[model samples]
Target: MRLFTIGFTQSSAAHFFGRLKEAGVTRLIDVRLNRRSQLAGFAKEGDLAWFARELCGIETEHALALAPTPALLGAYRAGEVDWPEYAARFKRLIARRRIETQLDRARLDGACLLCSEALPHHCHRRVVAEYLRETWGKVEVVDL
Candidate 1:
């Protein structure tokens, strides 16, 4: 199985959708704690769903189960918790949720995990991908 990860912070509409198309992403799984944001522009929940369907012929599904808890995100952003701690806690959350079993494995084959960060390195989407990869062997992750 193959999974892709991407962030919209530094990507324009063209660049973002273009990369998805290039990756042959069949579905975009939004993993943001807050999907609706005025500052998200084209990446806002409604707009992104519409564009993914109309422009790229890709499906969009918002998976709140994949997002960090609001308090965890707050603590991390407030610098109360460091990246390593945040990452550890997020991974544990995923385990507790048993997200791997709950997720549709078929849907993940060509799916991309979406987040707000511009880079995948520090994003929870990467952690999600890694968790899944570890659980489901032979899984390949492409950071977009």
Candidate 2:
């Protein structure tokens, strides 16, 4: 399976959509906990859905299962936990949710995991990709 991850922050409108189109992404799976936040700007649920279809002819799906739990996010943002600890707990959360079993391989083949971070290094999207790759057989991940 082929998977891609991307962050909307620090990216211009043109660059974000262009990257997805260039990568041949057929679907974008939003992994953010809050999909309708005003801070999202062009990345907001409604805008993204429309832009995706219009600009790239791709579909978008929001999957809360891929987001970090509120408590986990709070802890990390509050500095109560570091990246490694936050990552471990998030991985455990995925395991507990059995996300692998719930995943649709076909839908994910050309899908990109979406988040707001500027990079995947400290993001839950990377954890999702790594966890799925580790437990669900071979998967090629590209951080777009």
lDDT, residue 48, candidate 2: 93
lDDT of 2 by residue, 1-144 (tens): 899999999999999999999999989999999988998989998999999999999999999999998999999999999999999999999999999999998889989999999899999999999999998788999999
Please report how far candidate 1 places residue 99 from its true position, in Å: 0.4
lDDT: worst 10-residue window of model 2? 101-110
Q: Provide the clash count, candidate 1.
A: 0
How far off is model 2, as Cα RMSD? 0.6
TM of each candidate vs. truth: 0.98, 0.98
As for candidate 2, its clashing pairs are none
Model 1, 50-144: lDDT tens digits are 99999899999999999999999999999999999999999999999999899989989999999999998889999999999998888899999
Kindly report which residue stretches of model 2 are placed more than 4 angstroms away from their true locations once superposed: none
lDDT of each: 0.94, 0.95
Model 2: lDDT equals 0.95
Q: What is the number of backbone collisions in each predicted candidate, taken in the order shown?
A: 0, 0
Candidate 2 local lDDT, residue 27: 94
